[model samples]
Target: MRKVLNVIALLLLIMVPLLTACGGTSTDSGTSSPGNDSGTDSSGSDSGTKKHKIGILAPAVTHGWVAAVAYNAEARAKELSNDIDYQIQTSSNAEEMTSQLDDLMTWGAEAIVAFPQWEGMEVPIQKALDAGIKVVNFDIVIDAKGVYRVSGDNEDMGIQGAKYIVDKIGKEGNVVMLEVPTSGSVSELRKKGFVDTMKEIAPDMKIETYATKFTREDGLKDFADILTSTPKIDAVYSMDDETSIGVLQAIDEAGRTDIKVVTGGGGMQEYFKMMPENENIWIESALYSPAMVKDAVDVALKLLNGESVEEVKVIPTTIVDRDNYKDFLDDNSPY
Candidate 1:
């Protein structure tokens, strides 16, 4: 009886071990975030380095330069495809952009890189911050308090334009200014740089600021009146390529020969072509390419991946002239 009992006990022990090893259940369900897999890094929380969600926003191709912005952003997103789940959206105006921002929030975007080309994004950008989603504004600087910004050296572009215009036309000459109202600080920073630089370099120069749009049509109309009203216009610090083209047309139509140096900003192919042709007019442009949007995306990634990033990232400006314009020429590129 004792031997039989011993055999039964041994069999019971062996069977229990087999059952536990073959089929077992755990009490834990594993870690999970309710809706977002890539969420919760705005406060510098660590991400496990899996597939993250990134949202890219830009203005619809309003012009050649804007088209390049959207294109280069897509290219950069593709370049980081392995690590991120990205959605890029473009808008024609501020209202449309705000609606698009709502859509992005609903889609559970981990981080957003936006080119707020127009004004009136203050609310949406702030809401994004309140929700703990990382926000980075590109190009056109927004007035939103906490959002990060990445843009070309808009101020330096102005500084360079101011210096170039002063150098070519002499310290004291009548310089006409063409300003874009919708461009926000893009126009403001460039204007500020020029104004401040002029104060130091050429305080006595007769300067006049006129309102204009970025479109060639406005440039033509606004500058035509400018030419008519302001006689003896020695130089023009036109802040855009499209604007410069119109200004040139107005100058030619009016048969004005007094203006020697005509300055432009934002590299444009059409304007570059004119540089060599217009030997009489010292045609120059400060390089502010749309491809700088790529830097905004890069900074967003840095923030998402628990890496430190600056609140403002400024890309330095390069002056493009007839002598060096060929280097910036890309016939296939829209901008």
Candidate 2:
């Protein structure tokens, strides 16, 4: 009886081993299923990155900076292909963007990285957030309560411009404010920072503001009119690179040397190149790279992975001048 019991026990041990060998729960850590690993692509292939769907929305390239925004977003998406199933859509108007927003939802986009250049998008953006999609608003800050915002230091652009102008021409000079009305919150913040900072530093200074579009033609035309009408203009705060280009042209055409300082924003390669050569007028720009859109992609992925992300990712501005423009220069860059 004892020998028979011993034989049965040995047989049971051998059967258990065989059962585990055939098909059993693996002791291996971090696997989705038998085929799908931790980093499984849409094809269920191992690539060391968890699959996620991210959507990119941008305005049609109306200008060089917008073109760069689109380009950088695409480049970054391809760079993160192993981890992301990305769809990028560009729109020329708000209506087109509304339709594209719905299309993205239909495509099962779990996350969206949007640069809503046009206004009245608060509804669609909120709808996306309500649908359990994580929206990372880039470039322009929407008025939605919970959506994440990623943008440059527009206010600092104003602040830096103020400080530099004050230091260059003393606190008592007349300053021109070239404002883009369509810039929405970006323009508002920058205008506020400029006004507030200048008030703090130069209370006696007078600021003459004129509405302008973010185009070189407008800058050239409007500022040429401005130079003729307004006498003794010490500085001009043109908050856009394209517009500054036009303003510079206007100044050059008029051959005005009294304008001591011209301040602009948007990290344009062309404008940076103009900085060193033009020593007659102090030209400076507050750095705001369209390449910073890559951070929105990273933020979306982090949120999809259940990682914590900041509510407002305010990218700081770098004050660029002739001495430091070389650091930000990219010869092959589209912008």
Candidate 3:
């Protein structure tokens, strides 16, 4: 009985230390404590060697504007810091975007910047937020809470475009609008601003709006169809540079000399070049600069550094025309 008692006492002495080291406790079920770390320093703090990871989700480079955005974003990310790493994902459609976002999250991105090509991504955005990741939405507005959105004033672009038309046409002619995609927030705001301003300023002018996808091919096809159906189109206003290119193509093919002007948003290099020289088709373009990417990344860096930023950052827009185009034009500008 004495030997048995001695063996029991030795076992208790060994097991008690093991259990305590393993964080055994009556209140907790698991063997390890939730916040305890065995490798922490004397101050109970982690070393500051871990670098931050940033993820960028941009739409496919389908047009010059999108291409510029991607270029500037990649360039700025590399130029930002050595301790910060970035991964970029491009998606052709909404379904691909869903999967791309999932992969980004799984890669342990500390923060994400997105230019959503389509709507209905609120679920994925919310999921990232739930996981304690910061989200910065660029260009496109997702209408979700706790997201930092950065873009130019979309409605102001429309108001400027419409005011230009009214000034040029002098308030009384048939005008046609080649609109951007109705599903996009930028397009919708621009379209609304244009229509409202036209009604307020040029009430006598007859305005017709065509809702079409913002693509060169779609713009050409839709503009051609409209020209065939309508007898006279005094002026045409487009929401994108690619769509403007299409409208120009259709107008040249039809040999319609009656149309006075064509205007587009986005400072595409091609549009800037043509606006100064082109006599027949394009006359003006509103400057919705693609340099907003740089600003967004700058804001993200500030946030990561524990700095404060405005919840909504709005960049300025300018009207580019023959008179003032030279001021805003940069021959070496990528866009």
* Model 2 poorest 10 in a row by lDDT: 28-37
TM-score per candidate, in order? 0.83, 0.86, 0.82
Question: What RMSD value applies to candidate 2?
Answer: 7.6
**Model 3 misplacement above 4 A:** 1-49, 280-282
For model 1, the superposed segments whose C-alpha errors exceed 4 Å read 1-49
TM-score of structure candidate 2 = 0.86
After TM-score superposition, what is the CA distance of residue 284 in candidate 2 from its true location, in Å? 0.3
Top candidate, metric TM-score? 2
Give the per-residue lDDT of model 1 (tens digit) for 237-288.
9888888888899999999999998888788989988998887899999988
Give the Cα error of residue 308 in candidate 3, in Å. 0.9
Across 1-335, the per-residue lDDT of candidate 3 in tens digits comes to 99999999999999998989799544333221211222223343443444467788888977778888888887888775444667888988788887888898888777888888687788888888888888888888886778898898889988988888888777889999877675489888998888899889988889888877767898899999999999898898788877888888898899888888888888877777777676754478888888888888777777777899998899888888777776876776677
**lDDT of candidate 3 vs native?**
0.80
The sequence of per-residue lDDT tens digits that candidate 2 reaches over residues 1-335 is 99999999999989998988889654434424311224655464455655688889999978888889889888887787667778899999998998999999988889999999888999999999999999999978888867997889888888988999998999998889998888788888899999999999999889999999888889999999999999889999999989999999999999988998999899899999999888888889898998999898889989999999898899988988888989988988999
Per-residue error for 167 in candidate 3, Å, reads 0.5
Per-residue lDDT value at 49 in model 3: 46
**C-alpha lDDT score of every prediction, in listed order:** 0.85, 0.87, 0.80
